[model samples]
Target: MKNWIIIFIVSALVGFGAGYFIFQDKEEADGTNQTTTQEKESKQENVVKEESKDSNAPKTATTSDGGIFSEKGCISCHSVSALNIQGGATGPDLSKAYDNVEGKHGKPIKEFLKVPTSAVMSGVIEGNPLTDEEIEKIVEALKKAAEK
Candidate 1:
């Protein structure tokens, strides 16, 4: 009877020690996972904030020959930071239009002004093709904006 009692106590101690170690390991792994998740979330939030700051930055100097753009109602659908103008969001930002127009189109911006290719732009300028002088002035303004 005495020997049996001693053996039962020893088994119970072994079981308790094994359970303690297993549970401790699981708790440590859970803490590590939680920390990793928090770090990732923090990095994502920082990236979003940086992007937001860039988009919302204040406009700088106005475009040199912005009058032609304004006269042609280009200001109605385009935003040019160099021109310090914030138009509607309907059209792509003209601040970087020179790069796309001159590089991708492989033609002078004046030609595009005479006959815009995009459907949305075609509708906007359907009956209002810019004159030679107007196109020149607008091109000059866009080039200036792009340089900055």
Candidate 2:
């Protein structure tokens, strides 16, 4: 009985250590996500500052339409750092989409803006088309990321 008790305790300790390590790694991953978002925000601030310094530079809209996108349930398939992604769906990571658009395709923002969410990228959790404005805001966020 004593030997069994000892074995059980040892097993429990090993399980606990494994859980601790896994959780610690998860916390680190979350931290990295936060850091990435912060870096993006910082880069955006720099761009705004530069644009402001150049009076002739075209004005970039800072108004966040992220909420509207979230409210419309875009988060069901996409994630925006400062927006709703609680029920985020199984879509291709939007993180790299911008580069595929501008860098690879060499498409203008307006042309890139014409993506039909249903057809351009597959593996979406479900079919739900976003409004033109919502697409613009999401595209804007993507463009900002591309610039970085």
**What overall lDDT goes with each candidate model?**
0.67, 0.53
What TM-score does model 1 achieve against the real structure? Answer: 0.53
Give candidate 2's total backbone clashes: 1
16-77 per-residue lDDT for model 2 (tens digits): 99999998766644555444645644665565467658767644333453344344444445
lDDT of 1 by residue, 25-91 (tens): 6664455434563564466445434544676754322344475655566655677876676555787
lDDT of 1 at 93: 85
| Candidate 1 Cα deviation (angstroms), residue 138 | 0.4
Clashing pairs in 1: none
Collision count for each candidate, in order: 0, 1
Off by over 4 Å in 2: 1-65, 81-89, 102-131
- Tell me, by TM-score, which candidate is best: 1
> Which 10 consecutive residues of model 2 have the lowest summed lDDT?
120-129
Score every model by TM-score. Answer: 0.53, 0.35
Model 2's lDDT to the true fold? 0.53
Ten contiguous residues minimizing lDDT sum, candidate 1: 56-65
